[model samples]
Target chain A: MEEKPVRLDPWASAVKLEYDKLFRYFGIKPFQEVLPRVSQVFGDPLHLMRRGVIFGHRDYDKILEAYKSGERVALVTGFMPSGKFHFGHKMVADQIIYYQKLGFEIFIVIADAEAYAVRKLDRKKVIEIGLYEYVANLIALGLEKNKHTHIYFQTNYEKPYYRLIQMFSRKITMAEMEAIYGDLEPGKVVAALTQAADILHPQLEYFGGFKYVVVPVGADQDPHIRFTRDIADRFENELGLRRPASTYHRFQTGLDGNKMSSSRPDYTIFLSDPVDVAVRKLKRALTGGRATVEEQRRLGGVPENCTIYEFYVYHLLQDDRELARIYSECKEGRLLCGPDKQYAAELLAKFLEEHQRRLEKARDRVLDYVEPPEF
Target chain B: MEEKPVRLDPWASAVKLEYDKLFRYFGIKPFQEVLPRVSQVFGDPLHLMRRGVIFGHRDYDKILEAYKSGERVALVTGFMPSGKFHFGHKMVADQIIYYQKLGFEIFIVIADAEAYAVRKLDRKKVIEIGLYEYVANLIALGLEKNKHTHIYFQTNYEKPYYRLIQMFSRKITMAEMEAIYGDLEPGKVVAALTQAADILHPQLEYFGGFKYVVVPVGADQDPHIRFTRDIADRFENELGLRRPASTYHRFQTGLDGNKMSSSRPDYTIFLSDPVDVAVRKLKRALTGGRATVEEQRRLGGVPENCTIYEFYVYHLLQDDRELARIYSECKEGRLLCGPDKQYAAELLAKFLEEHQRRLEKARDRVLDYVEPPEF
Candidate 1:
């Protein structure tokens, strides 16, 4: 039987993503030149890279060349402070931390203005969430607090940044904007303009001008990346900016076997969830197990269809040998579904307990990473 | 013979403004309550008001009530800093100065962002023109150099001002923007957004919130006023801002009997022009005269159609008796067009010479009026 098609828009929760098909659809080159470079640059490929979760890129060679030339490259990945800060958001943070370890400058833009415009949230509430939830979680996730790491609120970085947004708005037409983001409202259009400004403003003359800047994003955010790259090209003569580079990563699947989303609390394991809440959520999660333990043992479980297996492969399992052992055991019927879920819940509980403790400390120092742009 | 219909839009330069029809078309009420109220408010009505040049208004009753109740009202009149600062711009400055004397707070916005976006001018060049030509000329025209008078560049005031602009963009739609400015490019849309921001930003909570604001504009700029008033109403529930009030003034007729514009250099005597240049320009101006001096003496010249006569009535002669005498002399064969042009040229030269001297002093003190907004 032919498989059903999956939807992949950014806002939907039920959209299933197929990485290889999406790479072809978006015209992104596969991340296949990873063998020698991964060893040379990272000593070993990161977990996300080794597992092919970050599957494609555009203009990434420019970033690699900048790194090889002993020149630093900047990384930008902004988040709208609208929904719950969840593990799905953590995927980008993970790559950002890896990039930070490789001596890349990191910029975290808390897109509070987008939240205000698109979500109709008040500025005060957006700012509160950006500080207490998103910034705190990002710091806990290993985003360094130094000159190389700059966090900023989109609405607050208005001086040169907003001026640049207005300038970029001139470079694009309403028809081009509609082509990229279909039938957008004025707020969404402004939000898209602001996002382009967020991506390219760091390359401005005062901010060291343009050499190479990389953005690590999920496949759904490719439109913003494409739009920014077009803007960078149009501004090539005037602003002297290089087209921005970006890597596309796969979306984290939800507990219900759909795409993870903050809008559905049951489907998302929020970064700030308490240990017991996370444990309860994992226990009730949907799995690709048989109806009976005896049948599960006989049939072996379909680990490829299991959210628990995905959590282990993507998040919790750091040891290659242990991950291989779990995979083989599930396929050979040596491991049962109940025990596997229990093990996953315990691992998540331990992680959440430690993360919550670190988040408290991170909250106190989050503001240190927020750099207000000079006038 | 039937008269030709007038064309009036913000971008055109050949519009013949029929004030009564325009007031009715733009939904502005005629200024018919000009009895004792004018003398009571302004001591004696300014020449623009006395001559019916300040002809119509919207929500102007709110401004009058605010003034009567001893509440301070604000006046905002922003100009795009793209062209020569001419006498056409001076009409708005003259009104601002009049309001300044009546204890009204004045805000003059140098719309440099709009110039950069719509005219594609560089930021540095726009800023230079804004300060040296526009702001200095306004100061020379009697805009006060006090705390009550604030002048700002739209791009430079990006922090709180741009945030307010993003907020307003959410309140409006592409359809609405198209309705106001038909089929605008993204640049012009942004310029329109920036203009609305310039109009409403002074009422932000940090800038003393909203009570009443009055914009002095020509008949053509009624679109911006109308658009901003709609935004003010849309944001009423959330921001509690009062609708902005506006008064419409007639456009100054060019020397060639067209609408005055800086793009046509021969038609405009720039504020920065030398006294000799102003005199030369007036000598070559269009006038309502017959084929010969004898025929003009017999038919009597039409002072109403003479640009030199308008220069005296609007800019040069402040004495009512002298202005009336000049008007009748040109109409009743007592004065010829050549001598009238020479007298008007001399009057303009003397005024411009003194104005240039004051402008030099104003240049050193322009920063006093440039208040960077605090969010």
Candidate 2:
């Protein structure tokens, strides 16, 4: 059978995907191949890496090599400040905090410009969300405020960084941009070039000199990664820019088994969601259970397609042995949906209660971390 | 006979025109209508305005009203540093100095980014030309170093200026941009928005406060002026931007009677050109002398078509009485091309010698005026 072609769009709210196609068609190597080296180089890999949540990569091997050699490496990522910060965003924050602990310099861009232009969000509202929601949540999640950790609103950045966007425009053609992004508009063109600058500015001499850069993004953002890599190659000799390494994580599935997004608030859980509210949502999530108890006992359960199990694997259960025991119990039909949901709810409630307390304090510290843009 | 359609292209190097189409089709009012008012409002008018060289305007009456009412007013213009600063650029420098002397705030943009991205000039060379040629010529032409006079390289501007470009993109569509500028590319899109920002940024609260703005440009730049006016209207409530008033001048005719440009070295005189070399080029200029001298005296020469007469009107002589004498003498065929060329060369040589002396000191003072981008 002939396979359908895949096209990734960074701007899409919910992207349906066959993740394996990323490895086969887009030259993204299976990230599992480098899992062992990650443990050896960084001394116990991130939970996402170990559990295979970060399922694919472009040049993560180079990132590992740079880490092992004690070379300067930086992690770059961005959040579109169009909505509330949710668990899907936390998944990225986890990767960023993990890299920061491993001594990678962090550059976080709050994409207020993209949110206002492409997403048509209110400018003042976008800036408010970027600060109180995104930056505050990252701080609550233990994003350190060191000299190496730099967070900036896209509109309020340094001159050299904006210069990169202007220089990159000369090398790429419109047809090439249209291929990755379906249609063109002035906003999208500027946003795309701005994104390239976000990913590659660490290598410019004006931005601290050269460093190996890696971007941790969702699978749907590969188009931006591919476009940025092409730009890096074209400017290799002139700007001394190298292709940025990237690892693509699978989307955090919503309670309804769709992609988790702030736009779908009913199924998604915000980090600041009240304890009872978050727990109630989790209790109603679809799980891996059969219709009849007799049938469930006879044919076990399918944890592979379960949203409840995904939450435990991605966030709640970090111990390998405990997570494995739960997996086996579900597979053997020993743990029913009702009892398993109750346990997941308790853990989720505890996590939200503690996070909210820290988030309250974090809100007051956002200005100390990054200055918001003045309208 | 039917009139041909007119399309103004800001990117094209040479544009042919029948000037009346701008007034009839594009709604550009004749500057002559406001000439007496300029003399009444700001004192003796500029030579260019008096001689009808600055032939058209859009909302210039508003600018005069703002100035007369003791409201803040600013003059904005740009120089694309693709090559040397020729007499064509000095014309703009003259207007800038004229406004500065009138106590109007001045904002001069060194379009280094546009030169690199649109003209495909070397980045380093563009910066060099912007400093040594463009900025130096403005300084030599007596652009005062006052608080009101601000100069900047496009790539190295402030955060709010770049922010305006980002926000402006939201309201404009690709189809709209392509309508004004045919066949779009990434660089041109950014350049167009950047130009709008250049003209309108003086009114932004972050730049200073709201001020009445006027741009002096050649006829080919009408597209940018029109585009910026539309942007100003769209952002009127949000950004508090008023549409900038503008006056359009006829392009300086080259010695060969084409558009005078830095790209056409033999026909265009650079402010930095050695006295002898500039005079040699001027001596070989095309003229309006009749085919036979006997016929020239009977049917007077057409001063309207003579390049030598243009030099006398545009530069060389600022006195209206002396310029009118030369025009009538040439029209009566009493002055042949040979003697006229010698007189114009002497004037050209004298201007270049004195200007080059000031230019030597001006080049050393460029850093005080504006900062260039570090690549």
Name the top TM-score candidate: 2
**lDDT accuracy of residue A9 in candidate 2:** 19
Q: List residue ranges in candidate 2 displaced over 4 A.
A: A1-17, B1-17
lDDT of 1: 0.78
Model 2 — TM-score against the truth? Answer: 0.95
- The local lDDT score (0 to 100) that residue B65 gets in candidate 2 is 97
Residue A189 of model 1, lDDT score: 78
- What is each predicted model's overall lDDT from 0 to 1? 0.78, 0.87
Task: Residues A1-375, candidate 2: write the lDDT tens digits.
Answer: 132222221112121256767777899887778989998898988888877788888889899999889888999999999889999999999999999999999999999999999998999999999999999999999999999999999999999988888888888889999998889999999999999999999887877889999999988899999999999999999999999999998889999988788888989999988888888888888787899988787766667678898898789988877787877777777888888899999889888989999999999999999998899
* Fraction of true A-B contacts recovered by candidate 2: 0.81
Cα deviation of B363, candidate 1, in Å? 4.6
- Compose the digit string of candidate 1's lDDT tens values, residues B1-375: 132232211112212346656655777876545424767765877777776667777887778888888876899888888877899888878888988898887778888777777788877778877887888888888887777777887767747778777778777888888887887777877788788878887787766666579988887788888898888888787776667898877778899999789888898888888888878988999998878999888767766677887787678888867877876666667799888888888888888989999999998867777743221
Clash pairs, candidate 1, are: none
Which regions of candidate 1 deviate over 4 angstroms?
A1-17, A21-26, A208-211, A290-299, A364-375, B1-17, B32-35, B360-375
Q: Number of clashes in model 2?
A: 0
Best by DockQ: 2
Q: Looking at candidate 1, what is the lDDT of residue B264?
A: 86
